[model samples]
Target: MTDEVSISRRRLLATSGSVLAAGAFGGCLGGAPSEGGRSGLPSKVEVTMTSRPTPKFEPRLTHVAVGGTVVWTLESGDHDSTAYHPDTYGPNRIPPDAEPWASETMSAVGETFEWTFDTPGVYDYVDTQAVCTAHEQIGNVGRIVVGNPELDPDAQPALRPPQSELPRIARTRLEELNEQTHSLLSDEATTSTEEP
Candidate 1:
């Protein structure tokens, strides 16, 4: 009787362990669930900020409609989102008519800040903290392209301020994002033209 009880207990322990391990592994593989809004025109999008090890923005790039809003969620450490405009002590990378925006420094996890893009253009921004941490030098930057705005010949970010100031990694990231934004705009243009 004692031997039988020991065997059953061991089997139960093994089964429970397997069940827990499988649950954890499955969750890891599933990734974060996406919460989307509208069809192709998301009303709101989120960008996560982290500062441990290094300060960075997850996704680094975001796209939204002209009136869409972007919410920055702090995941770790401190951060602030500031557009690259003369008013912010950075080059003019946002739309020529768009107003500069800067978020107050946030230090707690789960803290949030948001901005609405009312103009149609590509906007490049950085964490003002970059000045002290050299986050921009290390490629920690964020870009947002609103609507299907036509690219300005003379105001292209790749050829303007900050681009030359950024290091290889930051410049590379911007280049890749610029290509992606261009492709997206091109595709939207094609789609719109075909619709009518």
Candidate 2:
């Protein structure tokens, strides 16, 4: 009985020693430091969405750094990204003529789409699906502004209407008139002010 007790005590000590050794090794490998210890590399940023931000079926994204990548992960339903420029290459799997940078229709619940912007430019995109009648009319659209470090010190990204198809003169005049009316109502007048 004494011998058996001795063996059991030895086994318990061995097990406890092994557990302590493992914990020490994990700490050396940077596992949950107590304080002031360096961690590993930075993690990637992820963005999620349920539906298009625009009434026209477009997802809106703001400015990101020149080398940064924007990943649009669809958490729930179907979606796509159709760029305004037809001449430029778009989502790799999609056809060239579809859109400048259009992504294929993503129907799966966890579908993901990513775009990396290297050049400095303002890119506009839209969802081509016609399920919503007023989608495009009500502005189901998004914009991306890629700015260089030197060109844009403040990195002030902005969204503007596409310049390729200029607004009709009549529409422009009407917008101007509306702006003037608003200014008059607000009692703020300035001849150089422009419509947004």
Best by TM-score: 1
> How many clashes in each candidate?
0, 8
Compose the digit string of candidate 2's lDDT tens values, residues 1-196: 6999999999999989966874554343222223211221111223454554423222243344444455666664556666655443222211222224667767786787887665554445555545544233434455443432222213312122223342353234323333432332233123114323
Highest lDDT against the true fold, candidate: 1
Model 1 lDDT per residue over 1-196, tens place:
6999999999999989966774453233221223323334455668889976789886677766678788999998778898888798467778778888999888889999999888867888887764467666667778877766776646655324345655777777777767766776676688678665
Least accurate stretch of 10 residues (summed lDDT) in model 1?
Answer: 26-35
The TM-score of predicted model 2 comes to 0.44
Worst 10 residues of 2 by lDDT: 36-45
lDDT of each: 0.71, 0.43
Compared with the true structure, model 1 gives a TM-score of 0.71
